[model samples]
Target chain A: MTDKKEVFGMRFGQTAGGCAAAVLVAAMLAACTSSSTSSQSSSTSAPAGSNGTVIKIGVELPLSGGDAANGIPTNNGVLLAVEEANKAGVPGGFTFADDSLDDAVQGAHDPAQGAQNTKNFISDSAVLAMVGPFNSNVAKAEIPLTNDAELAEISPSNTNPGLTLGDDAKKLRTSHPDIDSYFRVCTTDDKQGAAGAQFARKLGFKKVFIVDDNETYGKGLADVFDAAFRKAGGSVLGHEHLTKNQQDFKALLTKAHSLGPDFIYYGGTTVTGGGLLRKQMADAGMGSIPYVGGDGISDDTFLKQAGSMANNSYYTVAAPEASKLASAKGFIAAYKAKFKSDVGPYSANAYTAAKIEIAAILKALQADGNKLPTRAEVRKNVAATKNFVSPIGNVGFDANGDTTAPILSIYKISGGKAQFVDQINLKT
Target chain B: MDIFLQQLVNGLSLGGIYALIALGYTMVYGIIELINFAHGDIYTLGTFVSLAVLLGLGVSGEVHGFTLVWVVLLTIVTAMLLCGIVGVLIERLAYRRLRNAPRLAPLITAIGVSFILENAMQLWRGPTPIAFPAVIPNPSLQFGGVEIAAKQILVVVLAFVMMAGLQLFIYRTKMGKAMRATAQDRDAAQLMGININTTIALTFLIGSALAGAAGFISGVYYQSTWFFNGFEAGLKAFTAAVLGGIGNVAGAMLGGFVIGLVEAFATQFIPQGAQWTNVVVFSVLVLVLVFRPSGLLGEALPEKV
Candidate 1:
């Protein structure tokens, strides 16, 4: 019995040892595969300094879901910018390459997805630079990921004041003061609001009623505009806050009518503010009141839904009119030829973002003659740039990565089209 | 006063549609003693069906002198018929087997079915709301410098017509009497040679059909709808039905209009977030329920013999 027990114990020990060995081998193989994959991609691709070396850039934009109506066109614009950069050729010897991904998953603008997308971009060894995450919410989610990964992120449309300036500006100036990986081409809501106030004054509106959708973006823009309007010698009739998925603005309109404000300033996107307001005001016999709004209302979808009742409303957008830019005509024509659709609100911004990305990669490659710079080095180089001349004029960032340029305009709804009035230069 | 009058007209019209839909809940609850959670989705289905009919016929937004109106009416009838069939089918598929089970079982089944219908709608029609073509002309009548749309009058009249016709059907018609008899005593009706199951099926069909018309009118009036509109509208109507006395048919209609007017009034004076409007409305509901648990017109059914 003792001999038999000894043999059984030995058998059991051998089996256990074999199982452990197999697990160890499996883990090793996984690590090996991951390393091999990265090394393989890195080695197979041409070196940044080599002739014909394709400089891989990451383009992140909402391509399918709620924001797709705006995002897809912006993506097309990035492609045009990349193609132009490739044609222009890097100062050394490099051409632009793009790896685009759809960030239009449900809650795409949520911070979780932003972090996940940033991680995914960073994991791709070829992608040295990234662009996008249109909404400020997305930017908030992504800033940390990009900061840690050291990959540069240039957002074309994130305008929330707090995203750049941490949660509270008083606590610490910006979200990541020491980190220079993040950049934004679009002017902040502060500038847009001031421009809207100026436009309201120019139109001879002495008293303006302000309404916000009570979201971060809407409330922020409303506060900024209210202050500016007051400074511009405008009387505030009333201020109202509304939530999402709300219909029936008759009561608010009635009160505003009683107040007898000459103009209405709605600081919210088209989904929450556009159709209901237009329809309600028209139904209330105030169709020609000349409402003013920010970039959130610049979408054609707003006009389409609001229909003819949306006529005479005004909106403030971040960039100049793409139609009038003589230099942008070629870019626009190329974009349409490629995408088979009109460029959306953020298209020019995305194009500029892509240019910024290419410029950073080229700078990084020049600094390191043999291999491409790490995401961190590229990010640092991107932040160091003092001036860049792209589609939207010179691209330069202040301490907050906000554009140094002061270009905001008021566009009127004429026959269901956004007709440009005059640019409101705040610097003046 | 003029603005109030105009808003009153809008509120009444909006309430009329709600009342029409509320009747469906009231009638279904009257017979089954279970809230038909899926009723709103059925209404949404009706709207989509009508939209499909209009689109299939290539009807444009241009109203060519009642031609579009006739087409829209046809579409509405078709939608109601389709919804009636669906209501009967759902009864057979989901509710029939659970007839003898606990009441909670059927209620849970109805909620599950509601989710399925909503998700299916999201799949069939993309998340974006399709703009329903405006069949009614934008009419503005200036009385004392206040403008009111004729569409408002049309909707309110349509609701009353549906309610009166339904009331007559229940009280005056043989099938209606059969439904009331089944509600009174199912076993006795079954013993008297009236098929209880058939009467229940008919109740669902009629209720769903009325709801279909309500949904169609809402779409036409608002000129837009999302797949999720049914959920919100459904919740509001459920509240309305409860407010009027769940089992009472006329009470449901009264409750719907009251809720609509209250909502319109709340939006006008309450400067709070429009989202808070629901809180205010539901708060009133709680207060009313505290005061009257059996509801405004509800009478307790006689104890079992």
Candidate 2:
């Protein structure tokens, strides 16, 4: 009788064990999020000279893990600018030194670590300015810290608009809302989405349907595209947000097909069903419709996943062709010589940002009567930087701290590769 | 009306794949009474296996005529055999030792095995989606705003044929009787002439082979797959197995079609239907569990104790 009770208890335990199998899937997903490639804080010492006082320029970037490729080159560009500034010499007998911190926690950028990096950069009294934070989410966390410290911060690649625009941005700098301490050399997503809408109108598309990956970046981009596209005299058929990892889009596409939209716009990255959405469009008879997307989908993965159906799909990248820009020739040569690698996508932008920071520091030093000036003086000069000529077109920041010249490059996929199409410069 | 018909076609095709996968879960559970969490990854492994065979044969784009027929059949067979052997090995290595242990022991080990298979595939094939060639020319016939592809019809037909064959194999063969006897009472079957080890291994072999067929079918239909696809597919198949009655093969098939139809109809009827499809399907699951714990077609067998 006791043996029978034990077997029954085991059967009940077996049923509980079945539920644990599902729990185990969730636990394994968390376990797979591993950390690797440690980040190091390396400082470059300026060569000593007559009456050379070492002034520091601090930087924060995701320098290890998966973001290493994106962060290392941008950091190198900043270092290159400091190296040049020191060799050329600064006013007040100042020799520039670099104090860089890595914000990556695990192969990916962590916002908390970025905020901590901002605090560390602020504590260094000799640190004149800050550059970095490759991702937008990281910037949101770091900006408030820099703003409170009256430290000048600049980003080379963050394209999200909420960082520098609107009353929401004003809330970040409550200490001095009127005086913005943050700036970015890259074009914003607002301009990119508008550019997509303008391009759609230029293509003579009368009606379009929009889809987003239901993520912050994708949804924001699509929202702007939806509004701007409607304002551009084009009819929006419908907008739908896709659940992440949802594979089959046949039913959704069939509904879209019935509406008879001439174009489809997907505001998402390759991993978030952008490529698969395009591929499966063929299954539902909407394969012939021209597909448009933002920089999220402008990846090699998109080209590879879409296969033969890749043709006629267009995507917009909110950056100039920096590598191909004639003005970037000198910077490109210096980058290759220094790093023994090709200038990455945003290397020129990083160079321009660093150069602009150096120029601002010199201006502040000249104003401070050749004396060591406060970070506030540097912040003022950087904010007052009007339309100045640099590598990535005109290098100047507007009141909201966006690039004065916002450019969007368009590319089309054909022959299983993305080919460069055109670049549109938004008149802001 | 045409839309209804179109969605029905889509439901049946997608449901067929689910049924194949559910049969695997149900068969393994019927014999050993373990959920076999690694079964989903076996399907994933089968996909990569077929992909390798096709690519090795210098296949790209679309192959036509007799070459297409042989290439697909050969790849599908290879995936099934390899995945079946893998299932058998997993039993012999990981689950066999834990068989006599507590129920939680083998269940956790199955989860561990599932993680290894997923990571192994990710390591070998890279983490991104690999493009499968469109060897199965998907030309749909359209009538009155309703579209149905030849591939969809083929998937449904092939799934039914495999399910029917599995049904016969489980009922008519000498091995089938041994499996049934062992499932009923392992000690009693051992007292007789039934080899319990062989019966359980056969269950895994047959179940895993069906999952392999499902992998091949989805690979050809979707034309692209990733290492992570197994998790999503496995979760849904697990839900279907529970909904049908975990230990019954026919119940799993019936439950699969129900889930598939529910998914398709939700997408068609609901606003932003794609967003709400998963919610509706899982809601059906929650309702079933609350009202009828034994599932739709499951028998309320009396506890021996």
Candidate 3:
């Protein structure tokens, strides 16, 4: 009787302890997740003007964790544009300020976080125009919210064509399908993919194998590459869509090796197994095969992550080489001086996007008789933007909100740096 | 057949690292019913320490034969020691307080420690994935149609050697006997003159040391690691531990290899296999648990304190 009673007491005590710990852990996990996702308490870098009127450019990007490699530099570019606009001074005695939000959760860009960030930006009254939500998937989530709120969002890096063209884009903005609120400064994946396919053939690669990171951006880019490469008379051995955050691709690479492709095409960023994939490809004895990707892998991070295997790899950026362009010289120097980091692949494109937004906001204010314009009025002005000279070249939007000044730049990795090779004029 | 052979090599190489991590989880659970959620981060911490040490020693871009062997051994040892100390501190500070508390308390505490370690690493190393320079030169070894990597062989051989050495230590060493006694029944072992605290701390020491080695090996193998790498890698190791019978030592080693082989084979043969790798891995886990609730090597038992 005594032994059984003690046993019961011990078990009961253990159960009670377990229950208490469970609640504490549950509460902590909840707190941790919420704090990580909510980067909405962003600081404004804009100075208060003499008129005490501050107009804000809401910035949303994957500004933390692994995506920071691309997103931070992009954010810096946007911030730089706002600083310049503040110095130049708008017509309405309004100071242009930036209110940024991070859509990154844990270490990568997340769509749900992007949606929440969009809501936060929409709730802010001072924000008339927004300058990001970089990834294509994040843009897809954010567009509906911005559209419903009549807030203008201009992405610097989104390349998926479905975000701007066809029935697919119409589905994203159900609130105002006729009045497009989403615009991107970069060219579409179709142009990039076609350019890559033709380039691969020119380099004498007859057989190609394709892989994607299995995200909206990656899959879309790979699909375009597949169709274009096939039409160019290059045999596509196989195309595989890798699971998100799936680290190991040795087996996939091994399988691709047997198919005996001369080239491997990856449609993903450095953060999404892009660098590791090429390194493992070398381990599978296919390291010498030229690897091609869209702008996602064109960043310097890709070169570092791909290591010694980075050589012979080629990628296409859907924007001009901002560093090489004479018009972009001042922006690049300013970006470097401010961020203490070299201009990333999409930094100039983001700068151009921000500049366009500021220009439209000033234009809207001018049309409003030097009064602060409504989100709708500012959005309309942004949509009406045509042949606005900027760092990345003449910026304009078509009816569908795709950049009219579409240009694709090709680059090859040499000495662990991306060397500009050729430019394909993507504008029809 | 060639694909199969190649994947076999890939699986074995990957499995060796998982087994090392799983051993830490299993040993901690065996000694104390606490899950040690931070075990995975301990592995990650190991990798960072190894990287720091390597960089400090000016080792980068593949060291030659003798220098390579010496530096790898030195770096792994330093990582293991640092990780072992951290494991001990974690137990002494966190798990020790909750040992007699409800089982859920320590389990939750383990998770808290996991976050703390991950966040701390993030703060130290920033958010982006840092590339570890290749320490081993890539060379292909031909076996008919199958080609194997020298690095793969090193990972497997080193893992097995450590596991074997651990086995000897457990069965032969007197401290090992004390640890076994403590694991069997804490109260009974206390009455039998076994120092329960020391034994438990020692268990954490060995387990975390092995995990640290795993971290070093994985970092060297993968060539890139982020602060969050440990979380996913930890889950996989935890799965291996559970698959092999959580408290069983030899079981973790076997389970690790099995999971690796399954993932590799599924990726090679399954249509859209890369997408289905986790589904297949978890499916096998569910199926195995349904048939054998105690896992493959686990003896049937009710809840224990």
Candidate 4:
């Protein structure tokens, strides 16, 4: 009986110890969660010019992971525009407050987290306008949440054609019900893909190897390019799929080399693929062959990763050269002074996005005599915006909140930097 | 023909390193009958330690170019010794306590230890691939019509030497005899006054030391290393161990060599279109299991009544 009692005592002791350990771990996690979140609370509020009223706006960008290369620049540009807006002052003594989140971490890719992030902004009530959710998938997740809350969101870099146009290939109808709270200052992937295909065909490449990193934007753009390329009487050698985080690509490269295509078209971000593709292509002794990628690989980091072979890669993007846009000179000068980091391929689009949002907000605040404008009113007013001239040129949303058929610029590697080659207007 | 041969030689070189890692898995399972999931991570940890040693010795791409080789060798030795100690410690803390417990207990403990090691590694090294400086610039050796790499030859030679040493020690030494006696019948061997605990620790020490050497070589070859490198490589090595016939020493070496060669050949054969090299490897494994349940060389022991 004493032995049994001692055994029972030891068992109880062990169970209590396990429970204590579990609780300690949970407590540590809770502590970390609280402290990290508190540090982010030091986010700067938009300065109230002469009056004390400021509108705080939240912007989500992927600043760390696969999308970090472009997303960080877009975020920086938005922040720069916000700073400029505060400097100029909103018409009736109003200032813009800014809250930034790094969606580049794991949470950014998850649609559930994107919806939750949108819900968090909606509940804040202080956030009158939102700048982004950089990737198209995140944009898709956030659109409904924003629409439900009647919040206005301007995406600086999302290029999915379906965001504005529904699954059917027709232009978005306001009465069709699906897209009201979403607006993008940037041109969609449909325009960019068609331009890339035309450029590839013009280059006299009859056979092409199409590859994608299997992402929301990468695959969608690849599908567009492939269809257009095929219709142009070009033989698609094959479409190869490479995954993210895979370092070894000798097998894929060797296979790609075997197909003996004149050119390779990659539809993906360059975080993982750039260096591997470059190194492998060089090893396969095909370093001279030209490869074209989308805006995802149009950054300097991608070039750095791709090494010397980056010299042969070209990308198509929406932004025209700063010299080409007469009004963009001042915005460019201010942006360069404000941001110490390298300018992204889509920095102009970001500045334009922030400018449009500030303009709509200012217009709404001016309309009311003594009453403060609610977020819902701001959303309706921003949607109804017309003849709003932005830094990039004339910007006005159609019923679907998309830019009126903008042109895309083809950028080629000239002396290690993406220089303007030509511009194709999708409107034609 | 030259490029094809060159790629083949490169494939062989990588195969040798995989085989060495696979040997570590086979030896540990051969003695204690537990798959040491932490073995590959031990290899990764060994590489990190080697990097610290290289940096500590002032061996960088910028300075004392050839002397870096000596520093790398020193680092490899120190890493192997440290890994050997870690292996023994794991046996004492985890497996030893579960010696008389259910079979599932030790397996679960091994998995738990693997996760603990992986997460701890992530904490130590941030989630980024750090480039390791190459010690030997002249890794190639041209002979007859084939140009063989010194690093590849070194890996294969060292792997065989370790296996031979292990084989001799097991068959000839007093501790080896005791280990075999314990493995064959644990309680009976304990009655005969053999220390089962020491034998188990010795097995882990030797097994982990071999894995440590392979890890150092792997880091040198790949040029980049990450915290998660161990998990993927460990899984491959485990598969190699089982393919060769788990708990069989010779079978492990054979399994490692076969898996390495087949993976290389699969890359050569599989169309670039589908990209099904990994799928092919798993498919081969399934077919092998269906045909030979006891593995290539594994023998089924008769039940004692």
Across A1-428, the per-residue lDDT of candidate 1 in tens digits comes to 22222222122112111222342243233223333322233244334565445667777765554445455566666767777777776764556666666655682334466567677788877778998776665566677677667778888776556556654432322345576577887766667788999888888889988888877666777888999999999999888887556655765676677678898898876666556676677666677787888766665456656777778888776666555566677767776676555555567778888877777777777788845567777787777766688666677877666777667767787777667777766653
Tens digits of per-residue lDDT for model 4, B1-305:
54356546645555566667877787787777788888888888877777777768776542345566567668789989988998889889988989889989999998888887778878886654555655655345665444565656776677677767877887799988887777778888899999888888998998888878887887666545667778877877787778767766666666666665565566656544234555766677777878998678773121212
lDDT tens digits, residues A385-422, model 3?
99989888888999999999887778888777667887
Per-residue lDDT of model 3, residues B64-130, tens digit only = 8899889989998999999999999998998998889988889899999999999999998876678
Give the lowest summed-lDDT range of ten residues in model 2 chain B. Answer: B296-305
Candidate 2, residues A31-91: lDDT per residue as tens digits? Answer: 2321121123334254556423777777787776656555666677787888898889777
TM for every model, in the order presented, reads 0.81, 0.87, 0.76, 0.74
Model 3: CA > 4 A from native: A1-177, A181-184, A188-191, A322-396, B136-138, B299-305
Which is the leading candidate under DockQ?
Answer: 3
Model 4 regions lying over 4 Å from their true place? A1-128, A133-141, A158-176, A187-238, A242-248, A258-277, A280-327, A335-350, A361-388, A393-428, B1-11, B58-69, B138-162, B172-174, B272-274, B299-305
State each model's CA lDDT, in order: 0.72, 0.79, 0.79, 0.67
Report how far off residue B147 is in candidate 1 (Å). Answer: 3.6
Note the DockQ of each predicted structure.
Answer: 0.28, 0.41, 0.46, 0.18
Regions more than 4 Å wrong, model 2:
A1-45, A50-52, A62-68, A83-89, A97-120, A137-141, A165-180, A323-341, A398-400, B100-105, B142-145, B287-293, B299-305
Of 1 and 2, the candidate ahead on DockQ is: 2
Better of 1 and 4 by DockQ: 1
| lDDT string, candidate 1, B46-79, tens digits | 8888788878888747576778669877988998
lDDT of 3 at A33: 40
